[model samples]
Target: MIFDFNKTTDISGWRVVDDGVMGGRSQGSFALNANGNGVFSGTVSLENNGGFSSVRYQTDQMALGSYSKFVLKLKGDGKSYQFRVRSSFRERFSYIGKFETTGKKQTIEIPFATMYPAFRGRTLDLDNYNGETLVEIAFLIGNKKAENFKLEIVSIAVE
Candidate 1:
């Protein structure tokens, strides 16, 4: 188990990052809900050329040589999101995997071999994730338009 959101889970390390960092007007927030789930919800504004919002967690570097995929148990507002990971916090790019969520609760699997390197919104030429070590994980919504989104996460694990 990488992270399991429950009534006693400490979520202070989770942070919201919006397009505001690059002069965009997006806003995002993260918190634990009454049902003991982690909720990432916010508005994605296109003002100032900003249309993305994200929540990220930085964790201790973990060796994942034996893990081939990441599993997420979540419920979304029928939107698409990107699940991202950084092999190292110092790296400028993240390995990203896109997923679409239904309004119902579901489990989504992301294979490390399919996560491609990307910086900002552009994909890089580097190879996919090597599944060596992971230091950061994030969820981002950037459909290039203004909208509101909410994603409730029960847990995240590696398999």
Candidate 2:
């Protein structure tokens, strides 16, 4: 329920995903800061551009089932962003959220049932994330225009 990027002692498991594979475009990468925050920072450009640039982290063992919600600490440059969640790796099912920047260290809460189908445009229960392994965590900025964006992730945890 409480996630603070300034400290990492409470998180039981964590991994960073910065693979450079994109949907026929370019890929985004995630990195950790020397300051010790699990930082997911990258740029989404327009040249040879495909979609977005994001950094992600996933917990190895998920024990936040009934808690069924996640709270994150984020800081960005006042641009549009997406908060994504995935239940399983094999199933490419995920929900995308569109939000603006906070420009400050603020807490963003993502509930399990609020994720909607991107294609069908219907509210789908993200119950699978409950007790289900936290597969992929991503920070992305879509490459719709020739804009440069950075999303710095501080911490991610279930509450």
Candidate 3:
């Protein structure tokens, strides 16, 4: 199933999550472009205990019973971003999948079996994601440095 941006009127379900939550000074925002794609842009700062910036989309439980991969169509600024999946709302850690962009539009395929569990940048000893449902998804840019970032997302799907 595909969540096509062109069919949505606004990015109402998306929200920014800067480091300020932990007393950091980073800033970020999410909005829908005129073409219906979602744009996640922000500045990452290492000030005041901050080291990361992200945006998350809360979705209904996604039953990926037999799906093993997630496909993302997007454009980025030649940087790396972490794709996170949460299987439960109260889970402290998320399954993370990392991908790098080439400064051009492309499709990125992330396999569930390759995702690792992590919390606050620390890798957990738990096994890779083999969950049947996903409650949330996020895109984070936290390269341990300060920088500006912009990512345009066309669609997200599972197959």
The numbered model that scores best in lDDT is: 1
Candidate 1 local lDDT, residue 108: 100
Error of 2 at 126 (Å): 9.6
> lDDT by residue for model 1 over 1-159, one digit each (tens)?
999999999999999999999999999999999999999999999999899999999999999999999999999999999999999878889999999999999999999999999998899999999999999999999998899999999999999
Give the poorly placed runs of model 1, Cα more than 4 Å off: none
In lDDT terms, how accurate is model 3? 0.89
Please provide, for model 3 over 1-159, each residue's C-alpha lDDT reduced to its tens digit, 9 standing for 90 to 100: 546787465677778889999999989998888788888898999999898889988888878988999999999999999999998888879999999999999999999999999999999999899858899999999999999999998988888
Model 3 misplacement above 4 A = none
Worst 10 residues of 1 by lDDT: 88-97
Say which prediction, candidate 1 or candidate 2, comes out ahead on lDDT: 1
lDDT of each: 0.96, 0.57, 0.89
Q: Candidate 2 or 3, higher lDDT?
A: 3
Model 2: runs farther than 4 Å from truth? 1-27, 58-63, 119-133
TM-score for candidate 2: 0.68
Each candidate's number of clashing pairs is 0, 1, 0
Q: List the residue pairs that clash in candidate 1.
A: none
